[model samples]
Target chain A: MKIPKPTIKRLALYYRCLNRYREEGVNFVSSKDIAERLNLKPSQVRKDLSYFGEFGKRGLGYNVVKLVDELARIIGVNKVWNVAIIGAGNLGTALANYPGLLKHKFKVVALFDNDREKVGKKIAGIPVFHVGDLIRLTQELNIEICVIAVPELAAQRVAEIAEEAGVKGIVNFSPVKLRTSIPVEDVDITLSFETLAYNILKANPEMLKLIEEQ
Target chain B: MKIPKPTIKRLALYYRCLNRYREEGVNFVSSKDIAERLNLKPSQVRKDLSYFGEFGKRGLGYNVVKLVDELARIIGVNKVWNVAIIGAGNLGTALANYPGLLKHKFKVVALFDNDREKVGKKIAGIPVFHVGDLIRLTQELNIEICVIAVPELAAQRVAEIAEEAGVKGIVNFSPVKLRTSIPVEDVDITLSFETLAYNILKANPEMLKLIEEQ
Candidate 1:
């Protein structure tokens, strides 16, 4: 069954929410309970979860552990994925040390950079290698995902190289649109700022009008 | 007139796409040309742009520079915004040095941390202040947005403090759901990993079936 893109995103959210519930020792959660926590309607949660299978009981609700395990499998987070970041810059170094990626079972196995000075260093204990070694090291380390953290101009080339190296997908951090054949998920930092700016402006119509008039 | 959330996101994309065209010296673009670059239908681009105002002509398409300027005003990126990051960890530090933010006119004016060791330091030339001074410094610097890069447990507290400091909105990077009354744009890094994992699994159904059967 082909799930809607939004449903897939919500499944990820549900997985995280269920993990929190399990941590808090909550055994069962109704769609309403999950909805309330995520600020969604009860029916929306039920509809989204229903796309997978019927896990909720008539009165006992859905078992937190069971749903979490199911969603983890469905979202493919149950397996540990080897990841390589293709930049040793601040963004890449920070992502190398980010605890959330490891918590989600996406391990950063290597860092790649063209800079000679950073090629031999380690960020968060992960070894940094020159981009020239990407194809060889990717196969040696069994990396599945390559994170494109290089500058905007170099992003497409890095992505092409990662694809040629036979990585499964890419988590792109550059602002440019990549032309790779692999699945690319963009984490646009400027787009987030623009979104926040839009929301802030929406909250103040006078400011928006003033700016628009200018 | 209220805009759909997805349309607003696409507006930002269009702004970026238009800027790219401007940089390449492309003077005008039809909806078809814009849509082709963004991998969307021409009608979708036309409809999204129509929400704000008419910009395209019958034969000339849309003037790239004029459309870019118009979008800059409509998306509220016309003015510079002062931003404060409420964590001096790797993620926060990387965000401070991210060139994309300054390019989009969102300046990182301060970074906040509770650790005594990093309190007096600077990341990317942005001063790191103790969390105790968040309110004072936020007010003094006229900060409009606070980026929450703290850990999961501290995310809510940091968001509450940011709201109390009278910031307009938040760009939350933590995995937890914040309970603040202000607007928040969550940049869930782990969720991106999960999305990529799902796509990978979908692409290789045999691997997915083997894992699911386990």
Candidate 2:
């Protein structure tokens, strides 16, 4: 079945919500419970889940444990993915150390950078390899996912190299549009701040004038 | 006029697209040009731009410089916003050093941390203040936005404190959903990975069995 992009995102969210409930020792939760926690309507949650298959029962809502396992398999978090980060910059290093990825079964096995000073060093026990070795090491390490955290100008080239290295997917942190055959997810950090800024401006029109004067 | 959230995001994308054009010395561009670069439909671009007011002429495309200036005001990037990060861990430090924020006029003036060791240090020349001083420091520094980069357990509490400090909006990086009266933009780093994983699995169903076996 073809799932809408927003539904796919909400599926991941439902997965996380279910995991939290399972941890709290709750076995069953109605769609209303999930919707309230996520600030969405119960119908929206039920409809998104219905895209995959019938999940929640009529009266019992949904089985939290069963749904967690089902969503985990559906979202492909059931396996550990060998990952490589293409930049050894602060963002890359932070992602390398981020606990959330490993908690969800995505492991950072190696970090690639062009700087010789950083190439031989280790951060958080993950070895940093030279970018030139991406193709060879990616095969040896069986790296399936590559994280692009380089500068804007270097992002495209690095993504090309990762594709050449047979990486299955890319999670780009750069601010540039990358043209690659492989699947890529752009994490535009600055855009969120800009969106929040626009929301603030909309709420307080007076602030717009002050900002304009400055 | 009330703009849709996605349109607001696209406006930021358009702003960046135009900035790149301005840098490249491009003088004029049709909606098609911007749409092509952003991978959106031309009609979508024209419709989004039309929400604010008319910009394009009958035969002539938008004047790049003029549109860039107009978008700058509409999106509120014309003003500099003082930003505070509510955690001084790796993620917070990475955000503090990220050049993109400064490039987009969101300055990381200070970082708040509960760790006493991190509280006194500086990252990227931005001072680290104790979380205890969030209210005082927020007012003293005129911080308008707060980034929630704390661990999931501490995220909501930090957000409550930030709201109590009278910050305008929040850019949340935590996994939990935040309940606040102010506007919030979540930057869920792991959700992107999960979504990408789902896409990969959808394309390669055989991988599912292998993953399940593991």
Candidate 3:
């Protein structure tokens, strides 16, 4: 069952929101609510969910606990997980210390940094090690995922190292393009800004105003 | 100049790749390179770019610098823009401090945190303020957009605050419903994970077993 790209993205959000609804003891949710959270139309939400199966009630919406369980199972976060973040830059450190990753089936078990100063340091209790130790530590811990947050210049080399490390998958955040014999997906966190920047520049032609503000 | 959602997402990647080619003094790029980098079909890239305009030469690929400039213009990153991030949590701060933002139109001008301890602190040179100050600072600074990085519990409230601040759009990383007046749209960052997670889990019921290897 290959879900659409957009749908896959929504599943993460639904699961996250469903977890909250459960904690708050909210048992039901309307598509309208999910639509509102996602900034989509109610019809779109209903359509996306219907493609999976008829889970939400026509009037009552979705059950918080059941939806949470379903979404968790759907997103693979239901399972316990160990993750490895490659690179110890600002983005990598932030994700290594991210609170949400800890709550999911993911844990940043290992950190790899080329900077001698950064190695042996810790981000959110995850030990930073030399990139040379990637395969050795990865095999030892049976790390599941690798998050590449290195510079574009180092991305391909780091990815090759990660592939050799026996990582199950890669969550890439760099702007560089990397290829792997193994499954590797590039997700640029820079896109959010790129999108916003594009929209803003479209509305305003002169860049100097923004420059002057700074 | 409203790019489709999927195409809009890919433009950033194309922009980056084109920049690489231009930096390397490569003048032309075929759709093949774009497809290869993004893991999409060459025809798909051609079709997607076709919607924008025929920037590609008949035999040669797209002009590297020219295409990049066109895309930078289309996506609106040609200028400098200020963004306000609500919620000074790990994710919010991560986004505020995300690199390349200052270089692009996306610059974090204000950070809003409800925690008294965090309210006045500066993360990555972005000043943190109380949520109460969102409207005033946003209006004064003319924050072009807002990023919601608060917890799920406080996500909606923070979004409402941003909406009241008169932001035209939002990028919501929180997993809660956010309703807004006209002109406010949220780009949900978590959706991609959820959808992909759903597919991965469905394909491999036991994610742990599949992801784990001795």
Best lDDT among the predictions, by candidate number: 2
Clashes of 2: 0
Candidate 2 local lDDT, B1-214, one digit each (tens) = 6676668878999999999999999999999999998877889899999998999986789999999999999988888899999988878988987888999999999999988988789999999999999999889999999999888899899999999999999999887789999999998789899998998887777888888777
| Candidate 1 Cα misplacement greater than 4 A, ranges | A1-7, A18-36, A39-70, A114-122, A129-131, A209-214, B1-4, B18-36, B40-70, B113-122, B127-132, B152-154
For candidate 2, lDDT tens digit of each residue in A26-64?
A: 989999999998877888888999998998899988999
- Deviation (Å) of B47 in candidate 1: 6.5
Candidate 2: give the TM-score of chain A. Answer: 0.93
Per-candidate clash tally? 0, 0, 13
Candidate 1 lDDT, tens digit per residue, A59-138?
99999999999999999998899999998887887798788889889999999999999988888999999999989988
Per-model fnat list: 0.82, 0.83, 0.41
**Candidate 3 lDDT tens digits, A1-214:** 5455556666676677678778888989998888786556778778777776788877788988888876675567766667788878766766776666666666778898989999988888889999998999988987867888777788889888887877766777775656876555556556776765555554555653654364
Q: What lDDT score is found at residue B48 in candidate 1?
A: 95
Model 1 TM-score?
0.80
Q: Which portions of model 2 miss their true places by more than 4 Å?
A: A1-75, A113-133, A151-157, A212-214, B25-28, B54-63, B115-121, B198-214
- lDDT score, candidate 1, position A210: 71
lDDT of each: 0.89, 0.90, 0.73
RMSD of 3: 6.3
Native-to-model Cα distance after best TM-score fit, residue B57 in candidate 3, in Å: 4.8
The local lDDT score (0 to 100) that residue B197 gets in candidate 2 is 93
